[model samples]
Target: MPEFSDELCARLREAFQRTRYDADGVLEALGAAAHAALGRGEPELAFRVSRYAGELGTLIRLFLLGGSEPSAEVEAALAPVTIEDALAVGLLRADGESLAAGLDIRPHGDEQGEWWVISDLDSDLLGGEVPPEHVLGVGHASLSLIRATIRRPVGTLLDLGTGCGVQALHGARHARRVTATDVSARALALADATFRLNGLDVELARGEWFAPVARRRFDQIVCNPPFVVGPPRVDYTYRDSGLAGDDASALVVRQLPAFLTEGGVGQLLASWLHVDGEDWADRVTRWLPPRADAWFVQRDVADPGLYVGTWLRDAGIDPRSPEGRAKASAWLDWFADNKVQGVGFGFVTLRRAEVAHPTIVCEDLRHAFDDPLGPEAGGWLDRVAWLREHGDDLLATRFRVPATVLLETVAGPGEEGWETTIRRLHRTDGPGWQHELDELATALLAGCRGALPLSDLLELLSFAHGDSVEELQDAALPMVRELVRHGMLEAA
Candidate 1:
């Protein structure tokens, strides 16, 4: 284990700031081509670009590119922090007359600000399979959870499986207090260093799943749990829970209600198994605890073969090798025996409501959406709650079309002439939801400008169509509720 020293960390921080080794600076140094190459893990182009960036380039090579530099060059790049200081902080090691990164340390941040994260070197850096206890740094899944999380201000928040504490740092922005827990002590050690480097004060706990925070409730909980569904034997502590297929995610969902306060929210990025003759929605809804409203969005699905291939490559196993083929065969057999038809990957947002049989929205939302979905998610929760309370009085409620909503019409040239064929409503913000509209619904929605009660507009439409108000209400209430639920119209 590496030692933690405030003096060493502070010195390293000043050196990083002085060299301008941040996200934007790195991007500027690498240019578009090299940065894109780096994103694909082909760092050769990035190495070529960084050669011209002076000290920033040197640091990138030493840390990100897994390259060693001469002792004199390393000292000049990190001036005040000597090679000995870097060694003491466990960031660099002395290899003959050169210094190499002991682990990967890079700058990661959002629009709020930039911060540094430290974790075990990737498989490429290690030149072999990752150790079981390897702690992951910032990753796509972690960023996905952060983007999906509703960042409303909260009294207390919990970040489960906080490998390297990336999500905990994000939660600290809106939360008064943050608690980060991980099952691996090595992960917590890395997380401790990450928090210190970023100057964030987070309570760190070590235990599996909810064990550390048992009997405690949080105002908000965000987790990117170990949800990879596979064989019982686990290799990576960061991604596998060593349980049977999908049991880890199921366990986390079952324990959510115990840790969330009333009206509290929980955001998770997880995977679930799909079996024959079982609806995916029901499988997920059954996992939800009582008094909890859930919004489950199934982002993508893969069959047994594809899922196995994907994870095998993720674990750094080269598929063309004999060992890799054997591992793939074993996983295929396991999936077949377990009757795993497919694996679904997605995000699940749970709100502990104050009512029984809480609202559940589970559907396959596979479209690309606007980033930073926090506000949209928070708004959706509020809309759902209000709908639950005022569903009966929607006819009398006045609603205005949101500024983000756009009605698009498509016309086609037919045998006679150009004629209108399709009309659909789309939201410009978050999710960018699109819905096709019927003729009467389009006319009705056009007049929803907060100028009149919905009932009045419906009555006018009823008169135009020569239909009774009761009949119109019965026919259109479901559509109106659907529009409101999806943020097409706002209650005035």
Candidate 2:
């Protein structure tokens, strides 16, 4: 772990600012193509472009491209922060006459601002398997949790297993007090450097899972846990919890409610097994605490072979190599013995609430949504609360259709002219939810402009369509509730 000190961190931050070594600066220094190539992990173009690009280019090559630079160039690039100080802080090492990065530090930013994140070097760059205690840098899973997390301001927020402190950095933006916990001391050390470099104050705790934050409750919590499912073993601290068969994810979900305040929300990324003769939804939902609302959106499902192969590759192990083949065999055997058929990867959002029957939904939402999901998550919880408040007298509530909701009519050529064959309602925002609507439901929604209560609308539809009011009420209530849950309708 890199030694963290206030003076060293401030000097590094000053060096970064002086050299213009940020996301935008790097993009401009390398141009469009090379910058995009660097993101894809192909750094040849970046190296070629940075050959003559001066101090900023030298910094990028040394830190991001995993390349060595002459001692004089490195010294000039990191001006104001001396070579001896950088080496003492474990930021660089002398490789003959050139200096190489002892740790990987890169500029990462969102709407809040740009900040530097420090972590262990990439295994690919090291040209070997990652060490058992290696800390991970920003990746897809961390970015997903960051984007999916609700950004509403809160009194307190907790980030569990905060590897490299990526999530904690974002949490600090909206939270007044942020507490981040990790089991690995190395991880905590790097996270501390990351926070200090960015000039943010965050509490760092060391312990496995929730041990560090026992008896503490936060208004919001976000975690991207070590959710890989396999035989009981720990090869890497970043991804393996040393628990058997998806229990790591299950343990986090089962224990989350205790750490959240009343009406608090927790969001996390998890993986679950799809065992033979078992419903995945039932298995996951059983982990939820009573009187809590939860939503599980499974983004992808992989068969056993694919699952094992994907994780092996993530560890920088070639699945076709002899050692990788041996590991794969044992992992596959474990899965077969446990009757595991597949694995599901997804995001879980849970809210602690006081209600008789909690709203728990698990579904496969594999389709891509262009908009950020943070608002959708908050809105879903709000809608659930609204539904619970009006459950007894739903017919008395006046509702309005949101402007984003659109009605689509599908027509086909019949024997005579074009005839409408299908009618559907599509939401243009969020996840773009769509539902097929019959004529009666269509008429009911068309009349839901907040002008009248649902009961009066149903009675008017019954009278116009020559149907019994009692039957219409029975049919429309469920549809109205579903629409409201998905943000298609709002209580006026």
lDDT of 2 by residue, 1-492 (tens): 547788878888999999899998999999999999988989999999998789999999999998999999999999888999889878898888899998999999997579999998887877777889889999888888888889999999999999999999999999999999999999999999999999999999999999999999999999999999999899999999999999999999999988899999999999999999999999999888787899998988999999899888888889999989999999999999999999999999999987789999898878888887788889988988888888888899898999999999999999999988999999999988888999999999999999899999999998899999999999998888889888999888
Which regions in candidate 1 have their CA more than 4 angstroms from the true location? 94-97, 411-421
Instruction: Report the Cα lDDT for residue 6, model 1.
Output: 73
Show model 2 residue runs off by greater than 4 Å: none
lDDT of each: 0.87, 0.92
Residue pairs of candidate 1 with colliding backbone atoms: none
Q: Which of the numbered candidates is closest to the native, going by highest TM-score?
A: 2
TM-score of candidate 1 to 2 decimals:
0.95
Deviation from native of the Cα of residue 344 in model 1, angstroms: 1.2
For the record, the alpha-carbon RMSD of candidate 1 to the native fold, in angstroms, is 2.0
Q: Provide the global lDDT of candidate 1 against the true structure.
A: 0.87
